[model samples]
Target: MSACSVFDRIFMAGLVEMNLSFASKYGAKALGR
Candidate 1:
């Protein structure tokens, strides 16, 4: 695999993790206390 592809995957994973954390934080409030 190329280094660019590896970096892209890591970047994407980081974004996904951030999004999941964001969603969990706000979604919990939107859904309920």
Candidate 2:
């Protein structure tokens, strides 16, 4: 793979991970169970 594509994928993956982690944290807090 090219360097540019590799970087793009890594960046996208990081963003996805951050989003999922944020959502999961809030969901858990909302339950309060």
Candidate 3:
């Protein structure tokens, strides 16, 4: 139970980092264009 929650939090942190990086890349590209 507790271990599953810990895994879930780590997974969500990775997901958030991915999303932020993706958005940042697209935003920079859009500005460059």
Candidate 4:
């Protein structure tokens, strides 16, 4: 695979991880309320 494609995959993975963490935090706050 090309370096550019590999970098793009890593970037997408990072975004997905960030979104998952953000969602979990929001869910926890909602539950607390």
Candidate 5:
């Protein structure tokens, strides 16, 4: 594949990971309360 495609995949992965982290952090706090 191309470099751009590789970068996009990495970017998307980071984005998903960040979202999951944010969601889990907030979700746990919300549930705890």
Candidate 6:
């Protein structure tokens, strides 16, 4: 595997984690309404 591929994988994983956290936060706010 190349360095670029490794970097891409890490970037994607970070995005996924960010999305999950954001979604959970939004969901909690919606439920609170």
Model 4 agreement with the true structure over 3-23: per-residue lDDT tens digits: 999999999999999999999
lDDT of 6: 0.97
Q: Candidate 3 lDDT, tens digit per residue, 1-33?
A: 699999999999999999999999999999995
User: Best-fitting candidate, measured by TM-score?
Assistant: 6
User: Model 1, range 1-33, lDDT digits (tens) per residue?
Assistant: 999999999999999999999999999999997
lDDT of 5 by residue, 1-33 (tens): 999999999999999999999999999999995
Cα misplacement distance, residue 13 of candidate 4 (Å): 0.5
Please give the lDDT score at residue 28 for candidate 3: 95
Model 1 alpha-carbon drift over 4 Å, by segment: none
lDDT of each: 0.98, 0.95, 0.96, 0.97, 0.98, 0.97
Q: Model 3, stretches more than 4 Å misplaced?
A: none
* Local distance difference test, candidate 2: 0.95
- Higher-ranked by TM-score: 1 or 5: 5
lDDT (Cα, tens digit) per residue for candidate 2, span 1-33: 899999999999999999999999998999984
Clashes of 4: 0
Candidate 1, position 17, lDDT: 100
Clashes by residue pair, model 5? none
Better of 4 and 6 by TM-score: 6
State every prediction's TM-score relative to the real structure. Answer: 0.83, 0.72, 0.82, 0.83, 0.87, 0.90
> Per-residue error at 21 for model 2, in Å?
0.6
Q: Which of the two, 1 or 2, has more lDDT?
A: 1
Task: Give the poorly placed runs of model 4, Cα more than 4 Å off.
Answer: none
lDDT of 1 at 33: 70
Judging by lDDT, tell me the better candidate of 2 and 4: 4
Off by over 4 Å in 5: none
lDDT rank order: 1, 5, 6, 4, 3, 2
List clash counts for every candidate, in order.
Answer: 0, 0, 0, 0, 0, 0
